[model samples]
Target: MEETTMLSLLPPALALLMIIATRKVLPSLGVGIIVGALILNDWAFIPSVSLIWEAFSSIFVSEGAINDWELFIILFLLILGIMASLISFSGGSRAFGDWALQRVKTRVGSQLITLIFGILVFIDDYFNSLTVGQVSRPLTDRHNVSRAKLAYIVDSAAAPICVLAPLSSWGAYIITIIDDILSDYSGIAYSGLQAFIYMLPMNFYALAAILFVFLVIVWKLDIGSMRKHEERAIVHQQLLDPTRKNVPGDHSQDLDTHHGSVSDLVIPIVALIISTISFMIFTGARAVDNATLLTIFAETDVARSLVYGGLIGLGASVLLTLSKRPSPFQMLRATWNGIKSMLPAIYILILAWIIVTIIDQLRTGEYLAGLIDGSIPTVFLPALLFIMAGLIAFSTGTSWGTFTILLPIAGEIASVLDLSMILPFLAAVLAGSILGDHCSPISDTTILSSTGAGSHHIDHVVTQLPYAILTAIGAFIGFLVLGMTGSTLGGLLVTLLIIVGIAFSLKSVITPLPEN
Candidate 1:
């Protein structure tokens, strides 16, 4: 671990393999954590057990106080779940579904609405996934869209859109890291924000992924396991796979959604969005003296703001539900069901966090970064970094972590070999991390997407892999073009052309699912 050895790769590899084989994410992560702990402790049983305990406890109790960031995130999830439940109990979801059905009128329209909503909620990926899922699920389900597909759409939008938006959590975090990287070298004319903007055009994966989502919806391009899920939805009217059990965030059969107006859902969602942005700016202002938009976003406490917004959203939901005048027993039942629905997601998140900690201790990312050597030609640097960053992120289940480890290495490599290529190299890392996060089963965004869509987690992961890979293929080609031609436009054009060709070819050959 200290020397960045290949041994660091084993645990995540084992966990991913087990997840694919068994379709049991929690147990796979638990096994990975145990194995990682054992490896870290030299295979000593007692020491490994102690390390595991410490890792688990540290999440809740850091430096003798509660870990506000981690706890607040959990709180936000619970609050959102409760709000969703109350909205359903008050008939907000059903009412909205009816309203959407009257206007939307087609599966393609419903999916497009979901995609647009996902893109608009780009302040944070977590907020985007859950909020879009909540608002779109009722509409999509009414249109006979599969939960797996909904989860895919949510997952695709979350990281890809956030990574591209300079006002988002992902952008803020990346900018801070870029600033640090810039300080290490001179003659780099661009500031962090400027560099981010320049690289936006070079972020092939993000752009390609977003475009692919639109194409998939418009072309009805359902392939792999996704086709099966879509067929089941259209033919049997089942949003989720019937064989899958213990799905997280599934309230399809648990709520009485028969008595509220469309405002019942809209008001709470609008309140949540407004309050969250307000708290983000407030908290960010307290952290910085200037209080400008960029600075505020860069310094903002995202998790804390989410918790505050969730409280307001929950309050709005409770007040609206109260107007319906449900009995005390019914209220309690709905609240319990809401809380219970989110427990599976909470459990998986904690386990994923623990395994991530173990992986960090193993120095898996550093080990991966160490693989790059000076012998490689500069023309291949962008493409290679993309693959490396993707592998690291896929293994670690964290795109930001991948960025932290690879960006510095990329900067160093570019400085030593070709300084002009710095932005392209950095852009590759960003694009790759998003690609990996989309594919990683243990990624928090991926897990939250499943929860939001009420899909079985494995189903989401399985169905999304092919789409993510296809985008990555387009991105990989784009990076190669950028490296050779030194033109962001050239790379982007080629990427789009390749994606369009592949999409149209697949559409022509594969039979579209029947309309219900």
Candidate 2:
């Protein structure tokens, strides 16, 4: 019954995914949910069409099963939409472009700054990618650099850096999971949360990803199809007049107006940064309360950040409106448009929440977890964990889902093997999941990063996959060496040195495209 139920859910979900891949959003999602519902409810026959109505009715009329996490994600998307809109309209994005461009004259410079931002924001991948992509796009394009590369830079660094940062959101979650696995295992005396700070220095994948981005940028490594695209952008730029493209510099997405100058942008962004820090401090304080509060805090902080983000955005929009410089009304309209645009992502998240809930409730998670733990040999565990994580993220298009599904399994498997190894395995899984999400076009953060860059999401995905895969392979090898040698920090440093050596070797080959 268990296998049959899990297997039965696959076709409808897959059929729905096919539609999503084809870019049919609404119908695809409706069908996807129907498939899950039918399989779970065990109706005599699949209700392909009627199930849609039933879903709607249940979602609207019956509130019991509505997952709060889904709602939280929806609210997160809406807040992001509003935030992006405000940034654009209020000139925060423009100022960032101007200021960033001033410092990043070369491709190497842009890549470095992007890597730095990724390192700094080491919290939420969504926030990191969106922030870095939007702020850096103008500068990268100005350098005749490809948008796809910029997406690669942001996506590659976002989650990896976050997982490594002890104070950031990703770090916190990574620690919590580690803590759980350790608490249960006899030999593993330390908690996941406590050890992350220590193990962070030893995380090979995170170190390798950062180094890879720098190498790809400085060396301008043209792997796979990206080489061709680079040539095309260069040839195309050389033919056109430099002044012809942005003559009046129409930066506004809505109209033909020129993008504002640096001052126009910098202040609000600073405000946002300041505001975020302030909110973080407040939340951190509130989080330290009793266990019950901690649980609520865990459930709500990610969403609370969104709420704070949205509120900050609203305030920034108001100020921009008052400035009368770009026309505040336009900002308001754009913000609304932004929120509307986020609707699809919101729905997809809700469905993800539902599916995760189903998986948990069915107790199928334990059986699957057992199978996974028992099947893999002890020696191959870390490598297998990373590969499995990447596949799950690639298929589901969400790293969080991969984390939710994989962490426990990896933890249990670690218990089944040597409990002391849980941290390494879990870290590998997290890193691999992040790699897949960053590179996969279907992944929401990747999509949003492209959206932030004003590039076709598919183009970004195509361009990034090579670099992402290369780094992942490097990380995998590094993990294998560490597991075999039982050497912490040794593999990561070696990987970094290897990446740097490759970067220098490739440096002479890539010339900048003729200035646009």
| Candidate 2 residue 283 C-alpha distance from true site, Å | 3.5
Q: What is the lDDT of residue 463 in candidate 1?
A: 96
Over all chains combined, what TM-score does candidate 1 have?
A: 0.99
Model 2: runs farther than 4 Å from truth? 4-100, 228-252, 256-261, 290-300, 325-376, 440-442, 497-516
lDDT of 1 by residue, 305-365 (tens): 9999999999999999999888898889888888988989999999999999999999999
Best by lDDT: 1
lDDT of 2 at 80: 55
Each prediction's RMSD over C-alphas, in Å, is 0.9, 5.4
lDDT tens readout by residue for model 2, 1-516: 355334543633563355547644435545555555556566535453455455444433456665443354456556656655655665556566667777767667866777787777765666676666656665665666666566677777777787777666666666666677667767665656567766775566667878878767666687665665566555664211232221111134533143555644455455555665556556666766654422332433664564576467557655654565556566667766667656544554445434434434343333333345476567677777777777666655667767788887887777767776777777778777777676654466776565555444445666777777767777777777667776667667666776666566666665644433
Tell me how far the alpha carbon of residue 328 in candidate 1 is from the true structure, in angstroms, after superposition. Answer: 0.6
Work out the TM-score per prediction.
0.99, 0.79
What TM-score would candidate 2 get against the native? 0.79
